[model samples]
Target: MSTMAPACGAQQPGNIPTPFDWWPFVAAPIIGGALVYVWTNGIPIINGIVGASGAALGFSTLTGGAAGAASIATLVLYYVLKADGCIRSVPKGANICFSGIVNDTTDENSTAVDILAPFAMGPAGVFDVVVKSTYWHYVTDDSFWVYCDDAGAAMLPCLVKSETACGGHIGSLVGVTVGAIGGVILGYLAAAAVGIAIGCTATGFFYLLCLIIAFIIAAIVAAVVAYAGAVIGGAAGEGIAAAANANDPVVKAWKGLSPGDIVTVQGNWVTDDSLGNNEIFYTTSINRTGNVGSPGPYTTAQADDAIPSDDCNSNSNPPPPR
Candidate 1:
């Protein structure tokens, strides 16, 4: 009888993607259009239909006003729905377990190492597991949330539970708000410049020339807005990191840390365990009572003491080993 080995790919437990990344991609274009419209006609409601149309038609013959509007809308929708997230460390020779929403997969081959079962954890969210061999061969790659599934068979199903909406909202909102404002401002500036040039040129034969220049300027502006929208969307999507980090108990504890305080952390860094690389550790020591040379036992009273250096140095003081 042949024994079946565990699935090759699986997502590790405790790692999940945040939801906020989807918002900025969705909102930035809408906001940008509104801003442009308001800047042109002083009304917010018609800004999307009017400003985007004007910018689009002004720039390219192939994409008329309507096409331009559709393009912008589509672009906005694409960004809002796009998936991006940090990567997970997978140990070699171990099966990766996947839970939550699994979408697609891609292969990443590098000279440093060959990564198999790079899967996309679709929009819904994802959790992953990685297998590592004892050799500790390569550094684990940062993981990402993807939009497709079945791309890598390495992902396997795990137990299901209630899904919590974490980190996604804040990240998306910040990106969308900033991107939209930037897009609108840039769009209006481009429109204004075009309008100015048209008004300034008085040559009778220059009417066509003025129109062409205006169109060119508007196109440039629209492109700028679109680029800004994407950037904002990307930032918003990435904001999940901040959200997750903010909620971490370790980070929370570190928040109150001062210069002269001694902090002992159970430091363990993610590394390629298969390659035999040593785990990275973090430690700090402080002399709250006095200068660097003079150390204290880090009593509660010394919390307010002003230590000269922010991070503890080797010669400063040593924290208790874990």
Candidate 2:
């Protein structure tokens, strides 16, 4: 027997067409998850672009979170992570150890000691001289300071308390931005899908009601997802930073540190981005090599003389750049 052709307006068995295919919505969460993954794991250029864009568009903790649960996270990241950058960076703490001669020491506003040692920045000679004179230097255009490179400085065996301090902040920023964006997308899509399905069964009045309900639900979902994403990003960023600092040997910032001392020192190696293009080792530990009094603090006259002179006649190993 021949089968009768189905009518145009009639629904065929097992051939019902959905007004809207929900499959496309699946990409929302997938793309978002991918962003979070890439950001937390430190995917290079792409993460940077996405993060900056998100911040500009009010989609990140760096800007959007003004007065609610989101704001809480923003404040926490800012104070705790030292999120001082226009684009936030989370500084990771670490420890390091090494032996070197005290080239110069300054206790001006903050106590600090400059050492002349074989730093990973290459055969350690003079940082300023080397950057200007040596063409084969490890210094690159990305150097945090004009004359010094934070990355190379962080690599020095005895320099920083946190080895990841150099570029570590980028990871946190990326994580927060990506996570926030992803969360909003995932939450909105999921909510929209549910809302549409619920609303699809109604006529005009009911549909309008559904639309309102859907919008409200979507807004709530998006906010929650965004908040959760930010928190997760901050946590992940911290973990990554901790992993980097895990094996480094701990040391303290030096106090009463003086010039001409044979010493081993350690501290937080950080770029002073606020003031000038320079790095500082906020010494937390100090060891006078050999006898306890062998490398004692410099005499007042000697210390004054060691102070960098405009004539460039000072004994500073890597003199301040002109």
- What tens-digit string does per-residue lDDT give for candidate 1 at 1-322? 1122222233244444333455557566765675465444554543554466564333232122222333454454443333222222122232211111111112222212111101111222112211111111111222221111222212211111100111332233344444444454455456555566457355767767766665555545555555444444444444444454545443333333332323222222233223222222111111122222223222222322332233323233322222
Q: How many residue pairs clash in all the candidates, one count each? A: 43, 11
Alpha-carbon shift of residue 219 in model 2 (angstroms): 5.8
In model 2, what lDDT does residue 260 have?
50
Per-residue lDDT of model 2, residues 1-322, tens digit only? 1122111121222322223443336544654565466435634543454455442222222112111223323432443344332133323333333333343433222111111100111111111111112111112212332332221221121223333332233343454455555545544455545654675455676766665565455445555654555444444544565576564443223333443554444444343333223232334455554322334332323323333232222233332222
Question: What's the lDDT for residue 279 in model 1?
Answer: 23
Model 2 residue runs over 4 Å out of place are 1-178, 186-224, 249-322
lDDT values, one for every candidate = 0.32, 0.35
Query: Which residue window of length 10 is worst by lDDT in model 1?
Result: 156-165
Model 1 per-residue lDDT at 148:
15
